[model samples]
Target: MRTSGRRIVFLVGLQGVAWLLPAGTIIQQEEREPGTSKVKAQATISIDAGKLRMEQEKPGEGKSVMIFDQSKQVVWMIEPAKNSYMELTAAQVQQMGGQMQQAMKQMEAELANMPPEQRKMVEQMMKQRMPAPQAEKEVTVREKGQGEKVGPYTCIHYEVLTSGKLTREVWTAPMDQTHLGGAEFKTFQALGEFFGKLSGQAPKGTWELSGMNQMQGFPVRVLEYEGPRATSEWMLVKAEQRSLDASLFTLPAGLKKSSMEGMSRE
Candidate 1:
């Protein structure tokens, strides 16, 4: 399975806009077992970004393309396919960029129109909702504890309270590779309400793992996020360490350059 560079770009955009919650924290644990590094698997991802949706298909052969959609219907497609490039006219790229700038300006105007007290409340609530870091505590090996299954994996459960008034309980499962799954991580309901008030949504909230997984003999890491209104899954399907073709990332020479230098000044 090859990774999609476009997905990485989208995830970076999402993280840039996501407001940090006071109760948010990341936990990772890995198991070093022999032959684990030898196993590899492929994965498909479905991402929903409010107005736009994208589907990624990763297989053993050929390059991957991301199908774009709007309201459940296909609208456009972008692919960093092998040998062949997805051609985009320079005018189209500039038009898309201009529309994005306009949409951002509109969203900023909406936020700016919010009442002063409401804005303060939103900020305070976000601060309180962010995940708190775990204290200087060591994991003690316990004789036994409760066990549960999340999805197809079994997880060990643990609970903690942060300095803020938020509590969290997490269930983690160890996979063969460094990839760890937080099958069951619960956060405060108030956090959801707080985000809702601020016009933010995290359907699954921010809980997932990032690390290496092999796709079609290539070592790649999958970074995924699921929230109430949006879900994004990304994989570094191909990396330099795996002998990926350098030409795969280059733009096509056949693309014509645009002559619109004076248009923006007007």
Candidate 2:
């Protein structure tokens, strides 16, 4: 789950073209729970044109790796401990979206039969997970006319609003500074769209969601809120541009790929 620190040194040879070679970028991020100063998880993200890999480690959850290959239009979720991987295609994600919608309907039906007090409690809890499907609302982003120095980069601050309520705040650095090109940014957006559909969750102004399109840069720090309470914070820790091998995006030979059905059964 780690990106190699090996650097591809540039040589000013006769052609002087070695310095022009494309380089992959690596970013480190730390996550914290709401109202807590202690970090709860850490993630390393590697970005190359048309591809991305993220490795996240959280307390008690071990490490998980996710790779998105734009060329194949598939995402691979790898479990190193099991030496296995799962591929999620657009069709599979769409099918899962339908399944989630059906489950939401079932939950709503059951909620109607619960005691009024219990229903209120449950509904309050569900707000943080999934918004009610019927409550359609557009997410909005606004520039706050402020900036922050996060890590080595200076970032513009912005706010995300859902139905006129503050839902998230973000600080972003320009794509040039983040070493993100058009293809890489597009792939990143696609990942957001896929996860949004798979989870049946409304967009909350993240870099991967609709609102981020208005933000004009890559997110460096993001703070998510539930009503008036800060729920989570993700801040960039480091970014490095270096050469990455194509094999980094490929699955290991001889490992079995698990199906969605097999995953659910487990």
Predicted model with the maximum TM-score: 2
lDDT of 1 by residue, 101-136 (tens): 576567557668899898777657744664321222
Q: What is the C-alpha RMSD of each candidate to the true structure, in Å?
A: 19.7, 7.2
- Candidate 2 ranges with C-alpha deviation above 4 Å: 1-15, 33-37, 102-129, 132-135, 199-210, 261-266
Q: lDDT scores for all predictions?
A: 0.31, 0.76
> What lDDT does candidate 1 reach at residue 210?
12
Candidate 2 per-residue C-alpha lDDT over 1-266 given as tens digits, one digit per residue, 9 for 90 to 100: 13332222322252367567778888888888755679988888888888888887878777777888877878888877677788888787788878878988898999999999999999999876675432266788999865678777788989999888898888889888887778778877877766666543422223354477788789988988878988889877777788888888877787778875554211
lDDT leader: 2
